[model samples]
Target: MSNTPIIEAIKLSKQFTKDGDFVLNSLSLSIPKNKFTAIIGYSGTGKSVFLRQVLGLDRATSGIVRVLGKELHNMEPAELNAFRKNLGVVFQDSALFDDQTVLENVCFPLKEHKRSMSEDKRKAIGSEKLKLSGLNEEHFNKFPEALSGGMKRRVALARALVLEPKILIYDEPTTGLDPVLKQKVDELILTTHKRRSSSTLVVTHDLPSALHFADHIVMLNAGAVLFEGSVSEFLKSSDNLVATFREQGLNKYGKN
Candidate 1:
């Protein structure tokens, strides 16, 4: 619905500053306006940090982060609070409160972002989102600890969608789940984009899902964009590094 690039990062770089050594090097990549972008890279490559920066959860050292064309690198506290609502990030942990019911977790965002919305309305919308994420009514009253890992991720997805965000950032959407449920997550990610048409950015190592769900793919190493192109282009890349990485071959990913 927005006539803006959902996310734009220009020469983005973040340093973890572990004894003055930078964990993340210069990063530069822009997400497609209205499509699924899968960012795949090896572990310890600042994938989570990159997502955090884009969602305004963390700040970049000396680079720019623009969401919907609004600069976020040095936004004030109030500005960050206002800007965070436009992006929904489903962390690797699902980040659900174990004390709360599934429905409560899903409605948390709506209540935070739209305080005036009635409780009944929020609950109804939450239920709808859960159903969309392949969750049934019976799961709504259960707490996070009782649910399986996949179900928790579904609740997380529902929560991410609760705000009707223009951008949904998924971090390893299919990790640690059973094969069947991994397929479910892949379908859910693809279906969410198809249904809402929201700009989606996925930070994942799920190569198969990345190849399947992504309209475009960006392969990163040491926070640098090593390969940027369509999924098909990625598969057909002539670069040996791209081929080796995509194929999960012997590449160690150190020379980004």
Candidate 2:
């Protein structure tokens, strides 16, 4: 794998209003290619904002964001749309369509992007991805409403992987899950990363999960990067912000 970053933010900043505080205050970081990176931070600290910038859902107030070697802000609408196909995102709430069966939900992306693909091909790919995400054929016909929280998340992940994206992004993936479910999700993420060899980025407050799965860690504070390094380097850092965050994580998760 290339050592070059799959995503790069150079002095990136985002402000909602002219006088409003910047949500991303000149943040800079590089997410290594084909690695698992956990973006950690407290609420309202720009973790999601940074994700938006990366996805090109929100433009920066200043500076630049480059994903897959292309500057996001400079991409035209159609260009950006094409660029987005390289990314797969699992949302915090699973975001599954309640009206659709698990199989149909997973096939939606193929329908949208692979217009030339036959229905059988789409279904085959969808089924394969769903299985990869740990959902068996029995769950394929069920609606999202019929599934548990963990099952719903698995469906969402299956849909995300249906595109065979080079980069996979997860937003607060373990938000409401119990400890057992959270560990399952974490393991599922790692399994998928290893299987697909995709660069994975997770924005989460689940500190224990982050530390357990991420090869690289980035912590944001007040819209800026407080720390970015390997997991061990992060743990050993003498930085006050990092130390406090680590302590709080340990206390909350009851992990040493």
Candidate 3:
């Protein structure tokens, strides 16, 4: 990865046609190379859409988005796919196929992108990734339906890392897990960063996890950035909105 920023949005603006209203207006942000950054926002504040814009899945009505110094809107199809390969996303549902065994699921990205690899090699790579996620060999043959929610999320994480992506994006990674599992996921997120040296962008309202794992936090409200700073700076601020956000978020899940 370059020592420069991996991703940045310059004066980005997006509008939705819901009753002729605007959703995102003049929003901008940056993600430093090889660092984990967390994004938090009020409900329906367009955090997901912002993520989509960065992924090139959603277009901004104005402004430019750059990934690795390449403009997102200007990339060709082949270029876009190659560009996207550098990114890995962990969805809220885990997005694991229910019928496929955990091993097969983890191997899907390799099969889809590099069809020439031998099955043995692919399985070996998949198994190694699962092990890195704290999963044992016993999980290989188990189907998604057979695993617990936390286990399935871990399997999804293993799949995300199987390709050794340069950027890893996560959406509410701790949603359904119990306290123990939530901490496990948090640790896994941190470990992934240190082990892979991958830049991470996570969208979550889980304040404690965000504060603990993120080097920087950006808060979105009313479809635009409300605050951006280090976790300690945010916690120390006397702003009412920030205080309320911190209080509600840190308390909702009964965390500090």
lDDT of every predicted structure (CA atoms): 0.83, 0.92, 0.86
Residue range 130-170, candidate 3, lDDT tens digits: 99999999879999998898898899999998888888999
Number of clashes in every candidate structure?
0, 0, 0
RMSD of each candidate relative to the true structure: 3.6, 1.2, 1.9
The total number of steric clashes, by the backbone 3 Å criterion, in model 2 comes to 0
Off by over 4 Å in 3: 1-3
lDDT by residue (tens digit), candidate 1, 68-174: 88888668988888777778778888999889999999998888888999999999999999999999999899999999999999899999888888889988888
Tell me how far the alpha carbon of residue 49 in candidate 1 is from the true structure, in angstroms, after superposition.
1.3
Per-candidate TM-scores read: 0.92, 0.97, 0.92
lDDT of 3: 0.86
Which TM-score value belongs to model 1? 0.92
Best by TM-score: 2
* Rank ordering of all candidates by lDDT, starting from the highest: 2, 3, 1
